[model samples]
Target chain A: MDFATLIQILDSTVRLATPLLFACLAGLFSERAGVFDIGLEGKMLAAAFLSGAVAAVTGNVWLGMFAGIGASLLMAAIHGLASITFRGNQLISGVAINFLAAGLTVLLGQNWFGLGGRTPALTSGGRFEPIILPFAEAMAPVPVLGPIYSELISGHSFPVYLAWAMVPATAWLLYRTRFGLRLRAVGENPAAVDTAGVSVTAIRYAAVAICGVLCGLAGAYLATGLAAGFGKDMTAGRGFIALAALIFAKWRPWYALGACLLFGFLEAVGNRFPNIDLGLIVLPAQFMQALPYILTVVILAGFVGKAIPPRAGGEPYVKER
Target chain B: MTAMPKWADAVLVPLISLLIAFVISGLVILAIGENPMEAMRIMVSGALGSTYGWGYTLYYATNFIFTGLAVSVAFHAGLFNIGGEGQAGVGGLGVALACLYIPWPHWSLALAAALVASAVFGAAWAAIPAWLQAKRGSHIVITTIMFNFIASALLVYVLVNILRPTGSMDASSARFAEHLRLPRLNEILALVGIPFNNRNPANISFLLGLVACVAVWVLMWRTRLGYELRAFGKSEKAAVYAGISPVKITMAAMLISGALAGMMAVNTVMGEAQRLILNSVEGAGFIGIAVALMGRSHPFGVLLAALLFGFLYQGGAELALWTKIPRELIVVIQALVILFTGALDNMVRRPVETLFLMARKGR
Candidate 1:
């Protein structure tokens, strides 16, 4: 690959990885608070549809973002209600939410827009236009770092920067804040958090809500930033991939960015090179697409390294008499 | 240990949950400017009113029965095998390879060969995750979900590059030989002097599904392995104390679960399509989760739940064709059912148990 092609791939990688970064961070918050959320995919889908639908109708990108976030939050509330209040199986709840989003998004989309389970294509006014950084055009004349800064980092939608910014923000929230300490405590041992006069339920609910907000942003980015409109199952398995990225990152915020970027780069390569010729052997595009999932499985199998989830993950906090 | 009567636990809770799910589904329909009652009527007549409807319904039920049994078997061993989709997909590959490559003297022998091959393939697909869960301490749920994606990618590659006939535009394999086609249900019923629809895809695999149900029932209840599986599911600590190997049980149950899921290929690929098609399994593997949940993971309950879902599927198809309602409405209903029955069981159970106890006290 030439330098331009390399820059092109990196540009797409930044665009593609933004959604995963958002979702991985979302999972980080919820799982850190002892809630294993597999419904991240569902929430993202629902948000994508709603945001796209709203943006198409109102012709406002910000409104679309809020609509997307609201849709995700509703699903998150349902997950919270099922797994926390009812003390139900968190995985099952997550599965149901996924199905619900997959079905409801299309169903409502068809009804609202009559476009066969797709939102109407958003115009430029409804979509998130790429923000050109200061001196990007001027810097392009220089060599090496100039093109890199201009082509790869400067020209992206606001969410791209927001997603990158969130890595540091999440790291600080997780490691520096009092609420962060309490949230980590609840995930590791809710009983102790409860004994300390903190409400385990409240902390978990807050964590889940934060997760919803981040997922909402991710979905909105997919629909309004990366793509023009909402398509049926547009989120595809990105949510699950995000979950995989979370595990690959060992649930750390900064590592999540790296994992997502790695997955994104793989996706970009799959898009750029449909088939790769390795002299004696030819690698198919399907193999390229499957690489992230395969790598995740290998990571999960402990060949690379062991990934331990939160200690109190997936368990509902039950008070003993 | 029990708060309510067995019958109520078995029947009443599901009924209430189903009712709630249907009501929500109805409201969704109403929100879409369609008449919920009319939709219900259309679904009923479309899926169950005629022999043709029953044919399609039973055909779908055949797929569900196999997949549901797969989930139930693993559920008994306290493992969630959501990889049914991937397993079933790989199983189709087995069925296709057996039918396409091997020349059998008779359809019976061909089916037998295909059944074994599919089971083996499906079990092999599930074995890695099962082994990981049993030995390496990897979460089966996550691994299985990842496997689903990998399985799809594998299927796409095999179909496009390896299985597709030369010059064919579609990514499906070549059709099976005329003689190898399974006997349709109508033909089978004609021998018994019963008139049935000849056009629908329902076939002998429906009978095989029924037989698998009985086989699963026996394996789950009548066998020592079944007893150990349930015991391990109930209390892993106690089972370990009693000398039952967790690794052994986990591997055995997942393999059986995968095999059962794999058998669904016999119905979809061998019986209906008579060829290996892309996405032939569709969402039946995921549907198995809802079926197993609604049926309480029992073989008999799986049968009833499978039939119900089969009805919903057929009816929803009809509704989509005739009305403004989308076929995805059925998926929404399935989601609601899963949400209520699987995740919010205690919501209805607690209230019902209290009511039952109050009635008993009054009596």
Candidate 2:
């Protein structure tokens, strides 16, 4: 409740929100291109496991991150092949991808590590080290802005800053670029885009691939930046939470940052205060954990506001038909 | 006219998909430096070789049967109800409350009351999402996913704060009274002079599951409502023009799905544990999706798919216990099965249909 505690909570918020930010942006890209991706969680989980394992084995976080991305991309390719190429049920494909990553990660982890589906603990070089901003020490002497700068924004690992930076970059890419215009058009009405000579399939595949890369970053952050290594099901429904954040943000980039940060703040508050007794009704931490999902459902039911999806979303484009 | 025989559509397509899934699963095993053939042998023997194995398999199958049927009923109504896990969890809570609070004089009366309680609770959990989907245009898939998390949170709160016995470390309800516990399957078998495994968790709920499958078949195929539901599913605009209320069909189908999902709790919570515990549903709800997909949304198909999964589950446990292969291998197989049968059906179907066409033309 105090300033220092508030700063501390915000610090953890930045850390926790980093993964959600990456994932929300990922979903935004895919859903905006007419491909509904519920497999974000699975991709993140696979990436987390692969990154953690590779980091532990090779003692290189960058290699770990790439390995994670590769794993996610492989799954994304499978999703694209099924839902895009074969015109399969997108939701079912997502569900299968989730199950596939979940099973394969633990099975491979147990077989390789022999430690009950967990990678080896990440060493110093295997993990992302917190980088101190140049003026953090100097800023610590100032009154109001000091702790906010030094504690809240200056000491997070690289991904936290990168995740924040991606918000604007994604906004620019989505709203100001020609590719983005075509992508939005494809999602809204693929037939028009196809008639205009833009390949809907190509645009969708690109979006899904972008989705895979962002999910990879999210997973890598969880493994090497947030925690020291991967644990089984370590993403732990964060992908779904990111999906909720996407809806809460109305599939926009800047709003996605706000949504992820808000959800992250709730998690931080929950962690800090496990149980809160208000003299009458006590609130459990589970409420905080479930808040994002509950709020999204409310938004979805149009209680707060309507959150409409892209018109052509979840439908495969069949040119001849 | 259909391009292929009805039997091929029903049987051949799924079989081919299953074969491809198994082959891919075998390759995965091989990649891990394990012999897929040996693993298959172990699974087959471990799950089907002994009475004990069959007991566990049947018990797990009972849970699947209920959840699978739940998914199938919804599929027929053109609704994808993936909230089976949450519904089943709430149903377990209902079962626990019914057993703990109700002072039933006999077990039969207790079972009946518990069944109704669970179905009601499960359906109630599903009702909000169904209503939103029906009236507000909310996607059922997303809403149900959110509800699953809400149900989990609710279960944790109830178990930890309300149901847990004082001074207990675990978050679970107190055990039900001894006489209230359902009879084990072996106990019933012994009454008829048939021998079976006595120590396994298999119980009378398995029989109830079989009965429910038959009931579902009757409800889905032999009833007027089923026709309306199927008609609505096939083409909503057409059904509307033909005088079917979309709202009514949506609510009815989801409610039936929810109730069927809820009944899975009878097998897990009442028959096996005799106490409600956190995570009692334990992914069986999701497994129902795979079962329904593989079974093509038919009750009899659901039964077979459920049994196959039950075998995988029991066999995977044995594999994990004995070999280097983990139990999650079964989940991988399940994913592959879903991918092939549900998502990538056209990958196999197209080639098969073409083959049939070519053969007919040649003839």
Candidate 3:
């Protein structure tokens, strides 16, 4: 492939993968802290609606970002209260959150905006623009990879950078910091953490809240970064994909990025294959559409070998009655 | 002023949960400028309006019966089979393929071929998660949820390309032959002077559902394998100590659940439809979870809850036609039922069990 084409592919891949990376890390945080966060999709959807609404009205992208995070925090708080505190079944609670967000968003969106299924398209003035660093742009003059650096790597919204940088930050936070230790401890053995004088509930709440924050950013990435407007069901099971990434990554923050990139590549290919014309390469657009999920099942079932979850993963911790 | 017995928990809990959900839904109805009282009344009448309505309601109930049994079967074996959606979807795909691709001279042959394909495909889908959990110790929850997405994508592909019916953008398929369909039960009932004479396909699936429910009860309570599955559910370690192979039980449970869900393909796709179509599963597999939960994982309880869901489905559609309120209110109500039932404490369990027993005996 030509350098320009390669650059285009890389640029598109990063832009697409950004949302998944944010979501995977979000799941990573919650799961690592022992709270199963299956409600990330719900949190993201709710935030996406709120973010677009705020951005459209005030025309302040930053305010919309904050609003998105705030909306997701509220969702995360509900999950925390139900699952971590009340000891509700995580799966049920997660499903409830999804149902609630889906119903509430449509209801309120229909009432608030006259639009049927989508928000009014936002202008560039309300979107987060891609930032190109001077040094990266300077690399464009060379022959072999210059176009790749300039066209592919240099341009993208802030979240693209943040998603990459969050890996190390999450890695250090998860492995290097005291909070990380407590979070891992809570997930591994809540009782042990409790005996060590750490409040398992509080740690879990914090972890889940962080997950919400990242999910919100991911949702905004879908709207402002990917499509520039909020579409009903736009998240479209991306949250579930993130969950798959978390599973594939075995709940590690750093590895989660790799997993997301793989999924992102699969998704990019699904979007890309419709253009390529070849015998045996031709799949119905819908089958191509489902390729990622099919791959996820295959991977989880056997293709990716075995995955080991935390010992105390699905169990709620409570002091002995 | 007498205190309720703790043993009445099951029945009481679901009832209380409904009361709470109604309170919440009432607030929602108020927000939309409709009277909650009028809305609820409209909903009830819409669901139970005519004999034909009951037919439609029965039709909805029949699918849930198979799907609910699918969910409960796994619960009885201590495996949460969340791949109901995927398995059902796959079964539907198989049925659609058989109906369209099989060049049988007779419709009965096509029907038989379609049904067999559906059962086999559904069983295989369920087998994947079972294999993962049984052999690899993979969590069924994550794997099954992943399977749902995979199923959606795979179905979309088949619907759009391979199975897409002529002159349709909706990713639907061509209709199966008329002879391949289940004969109208309303007409048969009409011959017997039955109350509902509408020609809807809401026919014998409910009867079939009842038989299966009873069969499930017998299998679980009376059979040797049932005891083994229940033992595994209650205490895996103890069951293992007793020389029960959990691996086999887990795999068998998932396969049965998948097949049960696949049986629902008949009610929705083959039995009900004039032709094979895309996305025939219609999220029934996912809704099965609610039925299973509301039924407290009991086969008979699942039957009643499935019927209740059928009523809501009918009511939801009718409410839209007859009232200013959105039909989605019924969906909200259904969601409420799931939430309340899932959260029902011991307070609801005993009463629910008692009621369930009374219903079974009454049946």
Candidate 4:
């Protein structure tokens, strides 16, 4: 391949990383607030189905995006209700949400769309189109990087920009704002925050709601942005990959984006590695597919120093009498 | 989250949540063009109507026994073994490899070897999370989910690279020898003239599952080890104060749970399918957590809960054949069961224990 082709490949790789970046930041928010939001996949799936259906019906991408986010916020709310309000087992509640979403969406999708496992195929009008940057097309006239500008940097869905933008916004919200301080305090010691007059529930719920909205956006990206419609499990295991990113990042927003890009780089590699001919590295495609999970396990199993979540990441705060 | 429970809330909460789930599910189904009542009818008849139908349900239930026991065992140790699917897959993979490659002629010996291999491999897979938690205080839930993905990926790779059976669309290992097939006395019920139709190999594993259930009961109730494990589950610091090693107890609990999960593969391969094919026990590992939760994490409860799960599964499969409903409805039913289980979970044992304590106080 020429230099142009190589650059184009690298650019498109970031395109593929968008949804993952969104979901990882989503996980970062909920988990950092002491909620074990393990049902990211379910939230993404539910959002995908809802967005696809709504987009197909309404023929409006933004509506679909909002609807998808709305679906996940509802899911996140349930997570909050169960884990925080009712104080149920964090893991079980998350698992239940996943199971509930998996079955419910499929059951509803098949009947509504008349597809065995999908919604109707959406048009560009009904979905996101890659936005071309102004004068970037003119920049394409330059040698060696023209194809790269057109394919990678110039043309990609709008959510790609938003996903990138979220990194800084999340960092600011989580580190610079008064809300961020309260969130940190709540995760570490709700007692201290409660004594200081912050309602732990309100802060935690807002954090979780943000988490849900991101998950919804991730789902919308998967269905309307990436593929133009929802496949049965269109989000596939991408939510889980986002999860892998969250763990690798150790619950920090900016780190999660970097982790997502790295994993998304692997994912992009998995999609293209068949073309690479390393003389004797005859590792099966199957093993390559397992790379993300393997990397996650290796990370979790102490390759990184102490994934020490906020001192109280999974605990619910009940005020002392 | 309180250890103690109020009486009025106990039964009503689970039932109400369950009712809400059903109503929500019904709304979804109605939105999708299916009748809720008709679907329920199909589900019940499909699981309970006939002997053959019941046999299939039992087969599903048999695996649940192990999965439930596996989850219950881990829950006791404060480890959430969510890798039931991956662990079961590995367990199935282990037995398949042994049957296809290991040089064993005697039927009983082959079965024993296969079961042992599965138990060890399954146990070993579980120890990854166990060691991580014990050594580094890494979160078991995340680690376990990560393990499930790794196991899933590894299973796919193993099937294609190593275990590909010839002339098959399904990637699987070579078929088990007939001698290794689980024996069926479901046919032998004819000797007393109470003849049953349908000749399926519903083998002695159900009986073995029952035995495992009893053994689990004994392990949890009759042994001092059980006492220590339970004490540790209730309060790790207290257990340590009582002189029990938290690490040792945790390691033992996880391994024991993994071993039981592995044995579910034996029951599937040697007892029924007689072959360790791909996706063996399928989602039984996940369903096992629900079983354990519903059973309130007691051995006897796990047994009864597994049977309930098996019944739904068998019924679900049968319902598909007889009705126009998709097989995925079974998944919906399983989800419902789990949702209800979680809703009921916080109160299940607390009240009964409270009652026992109250009686003791009164005396």
Residue-level lDDT tens digits of model 4 in B236-332: 9999999999888888888888888988887787777766566777788999988887777878778877877777677666655765455666577
Off by over 4 Å in 2: none
lDDT comparison, 3 vs 4, better candidate: 4
Model 4 residue B75 CA deviation (Å) reads 0.7
lDDT at residue B316 of model 4 (Cα atoms): 62
Q: What is the alpha-carbon interface RMSD for each candidate?
A: 0.6, 0.5, 2.8, 2.1
Per-residue lDDT over A224-299 for candidate 3, one digit per residue giving the tens place of the 0 to 100 score: 7788778777888889888888877878887788888887876776676564456667556555556666666666
Predicted complex 1: DockQ: 0.89
| Candidate 1 accuracy as lDDT | 0.95
* Each model's backbone clash number: 0, 0, 20, 3
Q: Pick the candidate with the highest lDDT.
A: 1
Candidate 1 docking classification? high
Evaluate candidate 3 and give its CAPRI docking class based on DockQ: acceptable
TM-score of chain B of each: 0.99, 0.99, 0.88, 0.85
Supply candidate 3's per-residue lDDT for A113: 73
Candidate 4: misplaced stretches above 4 Å?
A275-280, B1-33, B166-169, B188-194, B199-201, B322-324, B343-363
Residue-level lDDT of model 1, residues A18-40, one tens digit each, is 99999999999999999999999
Q: How does candidate 3 score on lDDT?
A: 0.78
The C-alpha lDDT values of all candidates are 0.95, 0.94, 0.78, 0.79
Q: Rank the models by lDDT, top first.
A: 1, 2, 4, 3
